[model samples]
Target: MRSAVVAALALGLLGACSAGTEPQTGDPAQATAAETPTMLASAPVDLAAAEPPECLSDGIAYATVGQDAGATTVAWAGAGDRGVLFAPQENGDVCQWSAEVARLAGAGYLVATYDWGASGQAGFQAALDVLKATGADRVAFVGASAGGTLAAGLADDLSAVAVVALSPPAQYGDVDARVEANQFTGPLQVFSSTDDPQVPAADSALVVRNDKTSIVTEVSGTAHGIEFMAPDGYHAEHVRGTIDTALSQGFGEG
Candidate 1:
C-alpha cells in the first residue's frame, strides 16, 4: 500500500514536470518516502529509474557562515562530504534554490548556496572554508554565468575535483577570468547555448587547458545560468548527471 502511494506521487511529479508546475514538496520532516523527479535531459542513464534520494523525505539542515556587517552568508546542509558550492550569476539571489536544494541533499550531497558577500574570491573561499570546517574533504563547484567564471578561477587554488560552469564568459564584466581557466587542471565541464544573447557560445572557447579533460557542451538553445540546473528546464537531467559524475569522481561510490 505504501509503495502504491509513492508510485502515485512519482507519476504526479512527472505530470508536474510536463505541465511546467513546481513539484509539490511536503515538509521533509514529515515525509515518509523518497520522492524524486524523473530524468529530463541529463540524468545518469542507469539511475534514470532509481528512487529519488532520501533528502526528499528528510528536510534540509540550514546554517550560516560570515556575519561581518553586510557580509552574511547562508548555507544549506545535506548528508555527505561530496560538497557542491553553487555560485550565482550577476546579482542573483542566494535564496533561489529553496526547492531544488533539498533534492540534491536527498541524493547524499552536501550542497551550499550563498550570495557574493565580499569579493568574489573572498566570498567563495569563505563558503568553501565553512564546508571544510564541517569535515567535507572532496568538493565540487557549480557556478552560473559570472559565478561560473569565479568557480573556474578557483579550480586550481582550491584543488577541487570538478567544476561545472554554465555560460561563463572570458571576462566577467571587466575582470579577466581566462587566467583562472588557464591555471586549472582538473575535470571541467562548461555548458553554453548558441541562443544565449548575453553570452555567446564562443566565449567558452577562451577556456584553455594544458593537461586536463575539458568537456564543452554547446547546447542549441538559450538556457543560461541556473536555468540549466532547473529540473524542468532543457538540461535538467543533464545537470543531475553532471553533479553525480562529479561526486563519483571526487569520492568513490558507496
Candidate 2:
C-alpha cells in the first residue's frame, strides 16, 4: 500500500512538471507534502522529471548525484568559477533555499541544493562533486541547523572559501561541529535566535571558530535555521545583507 502511494505521488509530480505548473512558494516549514519530494526506499525516483521550483524556473537544471541506492536529487543554476552549495535543515528540502539560490545565481554565481535522503555526508559530497564537475573551482557552503553543523564540520576539509551556519547546534548526530569549526581557518558566520527553543544562542556559539574571521550573530526572536533567511523572517534584511557581504569577501568580490 505504501509503495503504491509513493508511486502515485511520483506520477502526480511528473504530471505537474509536464503541465508547466508553477511551484507554490513561501515558508518551507509551511510547504505542503506535494511541494516537497522525498526519497523512495527501493529505488531512486527521478526528481528531475518534475519541474524545477518556481524560483528555479529561469534557467535552473536538475540532476541526480551519485547512483543506485546512494543517488540524491539536486537542482542547480547559473555557471561560474565561484559557486554556493546549500545544505537544508534535517526536516527541510531543496525548496527551502529556492529564493536564495535564485538570487545568488542571478548574481552570476553557480548555486546548488539537494535532498539529503539517507546518505548524509556522502550525499552532500556527491552534490559538491556535481558543482565541481559543472565548473566551480571555488565554492562556499551555506546551511541551516543540522545542515549547518555538517557544513561547518566539512568546510575545512572541503577547502570551502566561506561557511554560513544558521542556528547550528554545537553537535549534531556524531558530528562535532565545534571541533570542526575550531579547525577551520576560513571565514565562518553563525546565526541564531536568542530564544530558540531547540538550541540556545550560547550553544550555537560553540560552533564559532576562535579565528578572527569567525563570528556569531544572535537575534531577538525564536526563529531557527533557515527561518533567519526566509523572505518574511524577522531579521531577513540584516541577515541577508551580512551574508552577502561575507560571501563577497570570501569569493574576493568585496
Candidate 3:
C-alpha cells in the first residue's frame, strides 16, 4: 500500500512537471518581423545567476515574519488545510530544507520552511502564525538538530498535530526536549544514527516520552541531523518515506 501511494505521488509530480510544457499553437512563420524581434528581446534570462535556484523553483513563495533582528524569512508552497513547518539546523537556513519542502508540497500539504532568527523560539512562533494566517489548521513540525530540539520542546505548546525530530539532543541550549517530550501526548517520532558523534542514538532516545504514540528509530551510520534527509544520505529513502507516512497518518490524510 505504501509503495502504491508513493508511485501515485510520483505520477502526480510528473504530471505537474509536464503540465507547463505543452506545445504552443502558434507558427513562427506567421509572425511579423517587428514582433519577432520584440519577442527575442523579451525572452526570460537565467534567474539562477541572481538568486538560489531552490528559492525560485518548485513554485515556492517567500514572505517575512516578525521584524528587525527577530525577523525570519519563510519560503512556502502548495495549499491545503494540512501543513508542515520545517525548522533548520543550527547555523543553517531554510535552503537546507528545500528538497523536503518541495516533496511535502507536492504531496498536497502546505509546506513552510524558515531559519531560526535572533528571537529564537519567538521567531518560530511567528512562522507558525504565518502558516495559520495562510489557512493551515492542522500542522506538523519537522526539524533537525537544534531545530529538532525546538520542535520537540514547542510541539505541545503550539498545538502541533505531530512532531518529527532528526538527530535531536536531549537538551539544546536553553530548551529541554526531554521534559517537553514527557509533556506532549501527541505522536512524536525521533530519528538518529547509532554512530552519530554529536548525539548518539541512546542520547536521542532520551527525548522519547515512552508514550504509546512516541517512537525512536536508530539507523546504523554516522550521519546526523539534516544529513538523514539528503537524497544520497544513508537510508535516506526509507527515512523520508517513514516520515511521509507518519505525517499523512498524523494529519488524518492517510
Candidate 4:
C-alpha cells in the first residue's frame, strides 16, 4: 500500500520546475503533498497532445508554446519582440482559463497557459516556475481562488508584468505578506464580485504601489468566477470584454 501510494505521489510531484523564492515557501517541493521525488531521471512529462495551437493573434504569427521541463502543456499564442504569458486557474489544465488565454493570445502578444502543482489542486510555487520557464520578462497573472494565490505570489518575480486578480481569497498563509511587503510598480488590476460571500471584497481594497506604478485598476461585478463560473448569459461576455480591456491596456505599457 505504501509503495503504490508513493508511486502515485511521485508521478504527481514530477511537475513544478523550480523552488519557490517566497520566504514562507520553503523548498516548494516540500510545500504540501505526500512527499514525492521531484528530480527523477524519468523522461519529461508527456504532454505532447497539449501543445499550444498555432493560431494567429492580431495578425501576428506566434509559435505554439509548451514548457520542455516540468513538461507543462501551455496553450500559447501571439508573437512579438517581447513575450506575454497567461497562467490558467492554478494548474492551467481546466477549460475555464481557456477564454482568458484566448483574450491574451489574440491581442498580438505571446501568451502562455499551463498546469501547476498537480492538476489544479496544488499550486503554491507554480507562478514563479511558469514565468521562469516561459522566459516571459513581462507577464500577467489571472485566476480565481487558489489560482488567484498563484498570481499574487508571482507579483514579485515578474515585477515587470501587470498582475491582475479576480476574487482572490484573503487567507493564503504567508503569500499575502509577500504581496504586502513587495512593490508592484507595474500595472495592477484587481476585481472582486460584490455578491460573492466566500471571499472578502477587501482583497480588492488592498493595493500596493511604488513611485513607478502608474495604474491600479479595480473593477466590481455581481458574480463569482467571472472568468468561468458566472451563470448569466453575458457573464462570459463581461469577462471576455473585461479581459480584453485589461490585456489591451495592461499589455501595452505597464
Using lDDT as the measure, the top candidate is 2
Query: For candidate 1, what is the TM-score?
Result: 0.68
Residue 237 in model 3: shift from native, Å? 1.1
Q: What tens-digit string does per-residue lDDT give for candidate 4 at 55-158? A: 31221111112344433444343333234444455433534554444444344444445455344322323333333443445565665655565565556655
Ranking according to lDDT, highest score first:
2, 3, 1, 4
lDDT of 3 by residue, 1-254 (tens): 32332333234333322111111233322211110000011112110111223443334544455556666666555666787888888877778787776666655666777766675565567657656655579889988998888888888778888888999988887788885445777778899998999988988898887766788988887989999877667677777776777787687767
TM-scores of all candidate predictions against the true structure? 0.68, 0.77, 0.75, 0.56
Query: Where's the lowest-lDDT run of ten residues in candidate 3?
Result: 32-41
The 10-residue segment of model 2 with minimum total lDDT is: 32-41
lDDT of residue 227 for candidate 4: 46
Worst 10 residues of 1 by lDDT: 39-48
Whole-structure CA lDDT of model 2? 0.70
TM-score of 2: 0.77
Identify the candidate with maximal TM-score. 2
Between candidates 1 and 4, name the one with more favorable TM-score. Answer: 1
Each prediction's whole-model lDDT (CA): 0.59, 0.70, 0.66, 0.43
